[model samples]
Target: MTAFKPALILESVDEIPESAYIWHWKTEHHFPFHKHNKGQLTYVEGGAAFLYTRDKTYFLPARHYMWVPPGVEHYFQHRYPANYVRTIYFFTDEDDTSDPFYTRTGIYPVNNLLLEMILYTSKWDGNVLPGTKGYRFVKAIKNILPDISEQPLPITLPTTENTRLKPVLKFIQENLAESLTLESVGQEFNYSERTLIRLFRSTMDISFFQYLKLARMIRAMGYLLETDKTISEIAWDTGYNSVSAFSNTFYKLVGKRPSDFQ
Candidate 1:
């Protein structure tokens, strides 16, 4: 497939000293799977996307929001033509004057208040007259942070004791960058490739190859958030031989291009 880059427009990176930080980007950009070092609170302003993490995959549409903890590798797959994402990176260090980071959470309805706060925060012009309103506004947001964390996990994986599938899943997760074959994966589990296929379909409700792609996409998301690697390098490292091939698949899944992420 031919790779077509998605159009992305990123606003300035707002660096707030010591309290919190925010960044905004508007794009139909589908970024390959990647991760980040900071805890992230992301609101899908418009359009739809999927968020793949180690344990689950979240389908985020308009008005949906997500909270991700630091060091948890994740990525987004865009599902709409014109989606905008506004993300806030809450500094996690306790000594930085803010409270500790919230726990991981995924895909939940955006509350009206939360939505309004997001809009206000996105437009915050650093010059808040020193007063109770600013302090209260920040406090209110902080209070809701935990509520967001309490939202359910977006995607659920099967919890089967099949034992046979464990090693296979582990192998795929570990070798996300490799061109994986069901035959090779089955060999590691001492089963015929056909048997592995049956097991995955019966137990996971998805084909083995589908699961593998999801895994690769998940890993790609982590890299996109955490690293500054070029799109081509990221594609190769994530088992895509060509940037075009990777971008095509990513666009189909994420709805945007790799460059739009940064």
Candidate 2:
């Protein structure tokens, strides 16, 4: 097989033929914020990816896919090297406007049936024009998505641009394994605990502990997808002393145990 070239795809996606398009590639590069004129569905394999919007970040784990509606401003980040990504872009039908699914952006886990269907299209790529068998097959994939992908993964993190809070959030992310509390963080940043609490509430609409928990979970997710660490090691790295506590909290937030997630 030929090596994947991201520059070629990035330059040609806009000028492709009518109806639909498919591009499969292995990439470690991140895309800058951009939008498409048509709806897009991207399936991920081998490694994980993160989608960033203006105010939120969405996680797309392995064996999962993300739907980006037409004209939604966003970008994709690959934390690990050489992630396999299969993407298909389609023109929206007039009837699809009535359905809420085609209008919203989300990330969903892919079942075996959907996985097989997507991989079967590896024989073809780029500009699946109307009246061809490839176009019909891909259109069917688009039609069945709403029924199979009703629930999106709930691993989104709220983002902020406030100058005062950006450094605090960065500190929490860099020191997930360290003991973090409002008082400790305030001392590091030279603010009172009460003032820090109010800052979190006003700027991010979330508590300090709440944000810390979420940041830890997100880090744990990256470890689960991209590393060979044991559950106990991952728990320790994510600031948990006991495996049970980490497993329980992981399940509660991510709907799966660390072992199952791997």
TM-score of each candidate structure, all chains considered together:
0.49, 0.89
Candidate 2 residue spans exceeding 4 A from truth: 1-11, 16-18
Total clashing pairs in model 2:
0
lDDT of 1 at 139: 49
Q: lDDT of each structure?
A: 0.62, 0.84
The lDDT of model 2 is: 0.84
Error of 2 at 121 (Å): 2.5
Candidate 2 residue-wise lDDT, 179-227, digit = tens? 8999899999998999999998998798898888888888898899889
| Residue 214, model 1: Cα distance from true site in angstroms | 13
Best by lDDT: 2
